[model samples]
Target: MPDKFDTSLPPFDCLSDSQQQRLRDALDVAYFRAGETIIEADEACQQLYIIIKGSVEERAADGQEIFAHYTADDLFDVRAQLDARSRHHYQALEDTLCYLLPREHFIALYQSNSQFAAYFDGNLAQRQQLLDEAHQQQNLAEFILTKISDDNIQPCLIVPHDTNLTAVTQAMRDKRVDAALVKLNATPQYGIVTRTNLLHAVLLDSLPASTPVSQVATTPVISVNKGDFLFNAMLAMTRHKVKRVQVLDGDNVAGMLDLTQVLSLFSTHSHVLTLRIARAKTIDELALAAGSQHRLVETLFNNGIHTLFVMELIATVNEQIIEKAFQLVVPPEMHDRCCLIVMGSEGRGEQILKTDQDNALILQDGIDWPGCAQVMARLTQTLHQLGYPLCPGKVMVNNPQWVKPQSEWLHTLSDFVQAGTENAVMALAILADSHAVAGNRALLSPLQTHLHQLLADQELLLATFTRPALQFSVPLTLFGKLKTGKEGLDIKRGGIFPIVHGIRALALEHAIADNNTFARIDQLTRCRVLEPETASNLSEALKLFIKLRLRQQLGQQQDPQSRGMQQHLDISVLSRAERDLLRHSLHVVKKFKEWLGYHYQIRD
Candidate 1:
């Protein structure tokens, strides 16, 4: 043990008196000249160092360096000591002295103090994350190679009992001189001999290579479906300890799935869906394939895919589902006669989760039969069966009030716009987001034109419609801390709905036709209806609100009792960071509300 270790270092300040003295007695002071290499990359570390005075340059294996300057108190080599792997190079940049603590002794010291142990544990975790990123960059090919589908490869190289060796050998040579799959029928059911098997047959067993490939062919094939994700394929490969997996289309073998080739695709959800859609034959098949929408959303969220791109992808999938459903249900003659219009969130293309159906039909005026209502009723029922629930307020195809002829829709919009009553204003606000989902899209154009013409006079509509956006206040009290208790802040009322309504109000004022939240925000910003910073904040707030709602819906899906109650659970589960973000978002909504209240001259 060395005597007189310096306790002036900042890290040593946290230690208790007895602990400090123990560390001081055990530490060995080492001196290093400037430009000396303290630690070499890929060399194991056996000790921790507390900097007495020094600066070091840390470099990667590729020679990229970062200057890590340390004064009299900083700790260095903690990661090296914890990981026990020398994956980084550290060189002294200045003349320095450090107190070295052997790894075993320092670990023993940590075992006695929970706080000290936690501090090191946190540092170790951060270091591991950095190391993992570095390793991922270096060994990308190996990472890809591990993800090959299991279904493409056979379990063993064996042919059927009756097949001749000459045919098997010829088949193997034709397929690039390795192995051939043997099966009783046309489908691959077993595996046959390779070059290694031929050698074993001729040398070890004294049997000729031409004796019978079937005699040497292995039995049973290792297989996996094409739908399996890359990570799942990698896991299967690791578990089975096999290099190749056979790819199956359904019940039949489609092709060989080499681990190396499958891993190269980086098989994203969009890529998978594209492949699935390309091969799809009928409307019913497309509808079935659209079931992967939820997985696609989850994947996009996990992979940090762009928020706008995510919305666009979801919108495309929703359109495909609706289009396919309509194709399956509607008569070919009626297809040209009627149009499907989506309203509310679906029309806005901001729907992140499956919600209630809000749609209507716009049919041509000349073809109204008594059976039109029944046809629409069946269509609504089919949509409900496809996971979209009926709107509790009857804002769907089943509602005769919502479905009407193009001429009737125009007349209704003209009346509502001219009336300008509170009810008319409310109706117009909902109708503003109406978009064509299928059929004659031209039918919606006239209604949009009429609505915009009416909205040109902002004073009348702003006074009545704009008040809803300012209905809820941010839950901040006099002291500036968030007000919370038994029930959490109503995120929808206080944060999300307000921002959405405010943005929509601006869009309407400018006659900006874009309905998606992000797109509308961009349009509003460009028209000088909103500041750029405000638009960005509102977009972020909407994303957080949507994410929270999706999580709540997923939770409700897991529990039968919770399904009926659409409310999210208590907010205690949110991390400190999440709560902070929520507060910041709500503050933004509050500012927008104040702006709306002032602009509309509302007394409340």
Candidate 2:
């Protein structure tokens, strides 16, 4: 029967109806008792097995080690089927039932279906890319990816600089638009006059109707290119606090994009959310704005924006929120005397959801600000109020140890390098990713330069710094089965931290300046520290890990009682594609860890 076999799994799912029918027609159910060897080493493999029930293990030739385990819904022996021989012995872990697709029919289908063939033939990165492409096709939202063009822009109502407010108002009304473009006669610059500008000019200032609109128009009109993302246009409008933004095609004015139009497509009001953060005059106002960030993140993700883009955008928002809080607490006179820094994930700009605060402050040498500690503590409290969780290690601005003058900061780093203890090395590693968020950012440069110089050629310290990356196992069985826990899988510990820290360690060794993992990987590849193929796989693996963790984090947030389940990915609930991806990504992680161990010469 056609329904007897399921064609829903990937690779097979990609096959055509006729091809699937032929496969089903050739399919046969086979059984193996426990302790039986299904295929012997060097045997000529005649069929590809799709496990229908129970479990099987592919062992090394001597049967001393297992390569992989296959359970129900898992397929096996693709390599053997393609090569026409088994390199290893396959044994039934339990009484096993499997669907057998004979080799000749499988080869005919593999030779015919390029898409199906690519999955088995491609590397890890390429396989994940194939899955991502399929996922995007099924889930990508069109509106968020919309580009600015004439189709969405309103016709510009252009008027001369000398045009009277009354005439401009009438022109705007006739054009059925709320804003007019004032082309200055004296210069090539264009100014914008909105209905609010007209009303203020007449009602608030008591200007005569005959007054030139140019007097009230805002010069150097805010604009976005016609080729820019519609989402960016929305950001511009929010960041600038304008209802309409001028659209330009190169140097020429294209038209205008009204707030209402963008809101029509993006009902999330992300512009309004950003505007609230931008204009927050008090900590309470800022906190209210911060509360909406998670919702915005969910909306953007649900709209199918890439996670990297989301991280970059969210990092910008987070920095702004922090900078605003700092300015509110620290006196204006002290602003230039010190720089506020964020370390760890915040420093690297990979954080998508709000996590613990990992901030520090770097002071200008000999700045007399006795109240600095109190001000920093207030800033930290303000951030906490705004939804940033406190760092468990107290690695924040409020900690006296993290706040220091430039000269003292250099000394502290030198001391850390000299001490070379595990804790000190870890501290140095965290500071390696420091990014200045506010104030005299220059204060951090000399300190960073000193830290790098001290670390230069310090192989022992670097190895010790890298040693922690191997602290946690990859949570996969030797035979490629997922290793779970009471709280499911701790993806951050198992997958994300190793990749992030391993990349960080290599970056430090190569003296690469970028803090973001993806950027560091690119630089490492460019410097030949990492092979291009290895870099590509690491990048893909890290992306998958972060995306999966974010999914679980969002799920945890939705269920408050599950807050204790943070960062633990429940494997039982994963989709087939996600499970496949997770398993493949973990294998990449395992290999990278081995590479790190070899590079650092650290044995387990």
Candidate 3:
């Protein structure tokens, strides 16, 4: 009756009530005083023990401590107890009470419940397979369970290539469809004609209504397989920046899937948020729309949308938000004289969650708007109210030092590369990832071109730039174990920063213009600056690290106390597969850092 034999832990939690009852009946309560040996190294483990109300410490075969802490509700001797022997010893660190289930009963439960059995029986390799399954499950977006074929696709409205535009319009009106697929010349190749295309041709180009349907259509249409997951269709649409995708059944054209139709299945956020931002007539309306952005992110992440896709989509929306804010705060006449740029992650289009505002304004030479400072301050404040916290580093357009003329920006870039001070290196690093988000991007173009010229073949400068990549020790120990500190490993510091900054430096050295970390990795490989295998490995490592950081970040918001905790990750909270992944990814970080030091010839 003491807590009814807690079976709430894993493996046991998966058991049926009857199985649980059997466990409850068989469970024997046992006690151990402080320093008492519950199980000795190299001895047979008789019973699987669950710490009901005390702490137990585990030691390796050689008496070196490993993961020594197990508290209430924790289970021990899972692997070793199953095998009837263990190489490690477990001792009670204080007065302890444990619910012990005999090995035979555990085997019985294991025999009946495969999932429960598998959890206990799995070796490291099998656990890795479980991890793959877990990741694959996470990869499946909510919409992915439905295939394109499962949706009620409108029938294809097939028309001949030579059919007149008048007939095409009539056919579309009759079918009540916005788009039609054109069957061209008996070949599988097809074209697409939408209402917009027709309108564009007739009104702008002044084509007669009698013009051939083919003339109005876009040639070589994009399509999604009927059997592909609905999520894939969404990804296709996002990647192509299109509003619709053609559905195909092998060589035959099926029909078109409008973005509206597809998005209606899920949250309004997928499409409506962007639509609202585009149509919003006032800054107030845009602010209201921005409120739903975090919900959208949570939905996307919970449903397992890949981080990069979320990054791209969110960046687009955030840019629109910034653009709208700029329009609200700036006069139309002044827009042409200045370029607005987002630096750091925002500039790279890799920003997922809201972070500090890192923006600047580049005014044309000899151009200054009279109330520029106040206007920029208002813009930064608006973004903050919309959830973009102001940059602690003061790298915002509101800072006069950051808001400079294009000529000054040029001089500053030259100074940074030549001076090579820590501040200079940091400034150039930020600019290297900078992207013009609003206003005239061309005004900022010349500065980038000049900066590239300065960066080319500057070895000492390159080494200085790459030096930060080697700043943090990779969190993996020499034997490939995750080395945790009191606050846990700083995953961002030890993993993400190395990959992001290392690739950024190499990109600057090789004069690669891509700012996205993933794209930089690929470009480096394609240019043979980094080997394909190395690039591929580092890419996986970076993505996994990003995923973990994002999860921790998202997790923190749910609990206020968690937000106060350092970004250091306690690996104990991670599952076997996640721990393995982190361990492996940290190893990748180690190798990448070693290569960076070797490439730059850095030493202690």
Candidate 4:
């Protein structure tokens, strides 16, 4: 054995110094020649093996089916070591050197270190979560990722509705707080008076100090739940362009969260980005803000924040950027008369990197705008210039087919549902996930109701809508190894689309209103449309697929010459645990696809 073993790898990296030394002291080295059997099928495994160099393969009892590949720095056969025997054969594909840790020592280490042991035990989701938590612990400000609690909330001053503005101001000053909550006798029941509101009321509006504080307070204040994520509170502040928000426990006020409180934890880049986007008077300035988004995503992801949180944050940021673009380009008078909606991944709020513009315009009925076409064309051009590429399928607002009056849009959806042609079904599927980003959001409600009603009991149409999800193979071989092409695997088609489309079909069948896949999965579980375990597996699997694909996409984007090359999952570079997770995740996908096929009664 080498004088020092590498303790930097996962599972091992989680071990304490004493645990590492104990493991190292018990380690022994072994070598196997090419084509030699390291461990025969059904034979007792005396020790755990960690490859130092070269490659090995695990095969079935018959030695004809390959199950997995383990390469340099890959650890293997934890199951075999624990069970004392495995119904699989291990053979060296090339000359191999490995360090062996005796079964007794390994078991002792496993018992001593729960984290190290969890790496070997638990389901894929638990294992991935443990890894994520381990990663997050490395970042000092990851507390921002935690939910809002008493630790982050501050006590707020509450004044009666009849309290004068001067009294409220004095109360705020005495409490050393920037805002105070006012008790209202009306429907909202509560309103907030900030220093800004007080200033505007007294100076700008020239109101008297003796006026009731309720008159100066803003009603229906923007607030976040006490149980909501601190990051979400920041998102609310970014979205509404406010510095402070009330924290609520049920219907009652808990405390207040200020922008300064959040900034004090860590100087945030997302807030700066949103502020820039909000203040951008020209498209060029918005483009600059848009350009920095990818770097921000990279920073958050690398800092070990949860992937879902990152997605939610990016989705909100993207929405704000798009909304700002809309306000800058469209005529102010037409804003309330129309709604802007994004479809596909953008609509689902799952998009990370900039992709094609899949958007449309829903105008109010009987409204006439002479230069409407030109305005939409300009908006599309501005988005393209802001880093969002144009849709090759022409799904953007620039295309007149996608921009229409609400009445005509509902009619179009009805026609599509009734026709049930392949193209029509595909179109309906796309529109099912549409989300309004700008303009009057209420305008799309009628369309949502109409579409849901049209397909209320249309079993045949639902099945047809679900058929495309199973059209692509799951990219797994019979023995459960990943299948890849010369360009690597197109995870988008092989894994992501199947899960997304399958979930969408289920949601549509049950009229689940959530557009995001993760939300849809939870709602489906609550409705018992999917078993709890299956729903959990599917959610975890989809997260893995998206994470891997995002890594590949980012890698491709970083390479200048790789532009225009289709992004694919490069399996050769994955660690053994990741590859194992990928296989297990794909198995989850395969099982989901089978369930989809049977549930929908889909036939060849």
Specify the poorest-scoring 10-residue window by lDDT in model 4.
132-141
- Give the alpha carbon lDDT tens digit for every residue of 420-537 in model 4: 9999998999899999999998998888788788888999999999999999998887656688988787788888999999999999888888899999999999999999888988
Segments of candidate 3 deviating more than 4 angstroms: 1-132, 135-164, 174-176, 181-193, 196-208, 211-242, 246-255, 264-268, 334-337, 364-368, 476-488, 531-533, 558-566
lDDT of 3 by residue, 363-427 (tens): 98998578999989999998898888889899998899999989899998998888999999999
Off by over 4 Å in 4: 33-35, 40-43, 54-66, 92-96, 134-141, 186-188, 250-252, 558-563
Candidate 2: lDDT of 211?
95
Deviation from native of the Cα of residue 258 in model 4, angstroms: 0.8
Arranged by lDDT, best first? 4, 2, 3, 1
List per-prediction Cα lDDT, in the order shown: 0.67, 0.85, 0.79, 0.87
lDDT of model 1, residue 257: 53
Candidates in order, TM-scores: namely 0.56, 0.83, 0.71, 0.93
Pairs that collide, model 2: none
Error of 3 at 187 (Å): 15
Candidate 1 residue lDDT tens string, 28-62: 88888999998888888888876667766667756
Worst lDDT window (10 residues) for model 3? 123-132
The model with the greatest TM-score is 4
